[model samples]
Target: MKTQSRWIGFIAIGMLVLMTVAPAFGAGRPETTATEQVTLRYSWWGGESRHNAFLDVLDMFMEEHPHIRVEAEYGGFSGYRDRLSAQMAANNQPDVFMSGHLPPWDILPWDARKDLSQFDLDLSYYDDTLMATFYAPDGFLIGVPQAGGVGGSYLINATLLDELGLELPSMFWTWDDFAELAQSVYDASGGTVYGALDEAGGVPYANAGPPHFDISYHNTTITNENGLALTADQLRFTYEWWGRLRESGAVSPADITAQADDGANSPIVNRDVAMLPIAMGSFSRFQDNTPDTLVLFPAPAGPNEPFTFGPGMSYQISAHTAHPQEAALLIAFLTNRRETGIRMGTEVGVPASGMYRDLLIEQGLSEAEEAMFELQNWIIANRDVRGDITVHARYNEFRDLVRAEQQAMAFGRQTIDQTVDAVVRHARNLGMNVR
Candidate 1:
């Protein structure tokens, strides 16, 4: 009886001890159960390499966070914007989606995105100036920059230049020098290769292109508080310069330029042109498509130092997401994690986080990647002369209009002055408030 009583007492004491320690052990484990597990849908647009890198990162994220699942919806850049627009309209966008080159200001008016500042993301590693570009007018942190670097740069076919016995241009080469070097490329190549792609009709917002050059020339942004800061004469000068280049064959002809899609069809990749303007972040992808060695160079200097700050891409969470916390966690993992940075290399451009950038440098980089990294660092150091343009909601429409007009001018369907007039007239029609 005494033994039985003692056994009962020991069992009771053990149960009491377990009850005391069980809560502590439980605390160490995730509080979520099967019922509370989160599934986050993440979408991004990229090529095969970017898609693979992000998938690998997502796998790592899931492993570290068993309670969270990330469903990746990724594809090439084509039709991505339209598809995203469709999904957004249906109120079925992913929990997280990529905002290409610029913030999703068009969708923001629809209240389609969450203010990421409310999340528990650790953005301390990002530069304040860079972060400032991603905020909404109401001061919401609408999107986070995924990559950091000079968004405007020229990618040169170094192998072709060497073969043609031409020297690379100086780092601070002027617009005239660019014209001369481009002419030299054509002359030296004996007319087989053009000096540069005709970027006149390309995406104007690219800092390497005309709009930003106009900004540098006028010492102001293309748009201001009132409206279009650029004048018809300013725009005419840019088109006329390209017109001379096209006439001189220093740039690819209209048909050849039209073939450039920045993919396998790109003139630089096909070795049809010796130089092309590109977002510095895309150097690796372009490098991968060709056997020839490529190098990044600063966009030719203008009247004033050009504005060079742009996040190559940004990641924004959907306000409609059922799991904001999980989406935030995925974003934090992708952008701020050292492992992810190493894996991504310069795939998305240089890392936006200083810590990740430093870690990538420490991990060693390819020659091409090292060049991109060095260029990004240089831009960051010289980013004191910064400016901002008021991006209109119909900005894409305006961009398309400019590109079409450029093509029309290139094909001799319209004069530069007429192109400028049409641009101004249509810009106003599109509610751009063109001055």
Candidate 2:
């Protein structure tokens, strides 16, 4: 009888122990219900319209899932990278953050974002080539393209072009053709209104060239798998191309072009320039600035093929998030939901999902928005998803150095050969594998 009683006592103790340990380990516990509170932090950089649109989407998300609360962190693009880096260093990065799809940005590193393949997010409606751009070095998708990753376009002031009596160029127009049209606009406007912005002067020169983003000096790509693949002669061609525009008054001089920083001061918004080379997603801002009808068309092609592309943005989740499931759900709502895309419009970019894009199209879009969507579609159908060039952290610095030299060449302060030499030397000094 005593042995039986002792065995029963032992079993009771074991059960008590398990009950005590179960709460601590959270093992075999019932899952939290939808009524449980889940708060997530999301950050992005954009203007007021983007901010409002995001808030509206977040509001809708909260309404549908009442238990999840989202904290908003947003601001202008300036210092955004620095802020994100600081937050990450402190291990307090936002659960969801805006990440650039292009290389050498804050979130491009494999380690910077979580491998989202483990999540249950739906990406079936996205284009394969467009989807591939967001993959990490290990082929794990780290983010979903925002809008459709806005590509470069010729943001034409149709009103200005009409007033000038110049027809808009075809989507597949060549660089030589673009130059002729620009010259015609210049001559017809009697030099008061310029043909286009000197995209080489202040704007990034990569976008200034024809749409082929991968073109190198003597090769098909500017940067190869090993390193910088451009030659001095190829670099010279870029400078001389822009210099000719300055010579013909097709574009403004460096000093004059430097003042066009967008908003009310932008040459496009002010109607001082007939066309501007810019990303397709930014059309709304230019349109909002003026009542003039604006249209977006594919960038002029290079000598070989189309190179301009939608280097899209994405909503990347942090690996350190305490609410991974909630964060993933939020990302799905923002990136995959057709309603969210419709609400955001081109504020983010064209919708990344094919279904979302189709839905947005059916809902009807402004002329500018329609043009952006068409351009994105064309890019997906036509442009090659070139492999990324591993640029150093000082990539932008090198670009600035080259820009200064290009401006010097444009102003006749430096020769084209001198400009090329300076750029190559500067790039090499930055530890870039320039050819």
Name the top lDDT candidate: 1
lDDT of 1 by residue, 1-435 (tens): 999999999999999999999855531233234457887889988888889999999999999988888889999876788898888887778889987435222323425788888988888998887877677667788677887765557889999999999999888787788889999999998899999988775533332236545655676544544545678887787788888999998998878765577666678988899998877777887888999999998777777866664663678888777777778888888888888888877677777788888887787877987998788777666644231345566666666777778778887889989988987886788777776
Q: Which whole-number lDDT from 0 to 100 does residue 355 have in model 2?
A: 82
Error (Å) of candidate 1 at residue 13 is 57
TM-score, cand. 1 vs. native? 0.84
Flag regions of model 1 displaced more than 4 Å: 1-35, 101-111, 201-209, 220-227, 384-387
TM per prediction: 0.84, 0.84
Candidate 2 error regions (>4 Å): 1-37, 103-107, 204-227, 385-390
List, residue by residue over 1-435, the lDDT tens digit for candidate 2. Answer: 999999999999999999988746632334345568977889999998889999999999999888999999999977887898888886778889997746434434566777889899888998777777677667777788776754546778888888889898887776777788888889989988888887666454243222242352233433333445567777667667867898888987676675676665678888677877776666777788898888887666775655543365788898777777888889999877767878887777677778877777787877766777777777667666443534455655666676676667766788778877887888788777876
TM-score of 2: 0.84
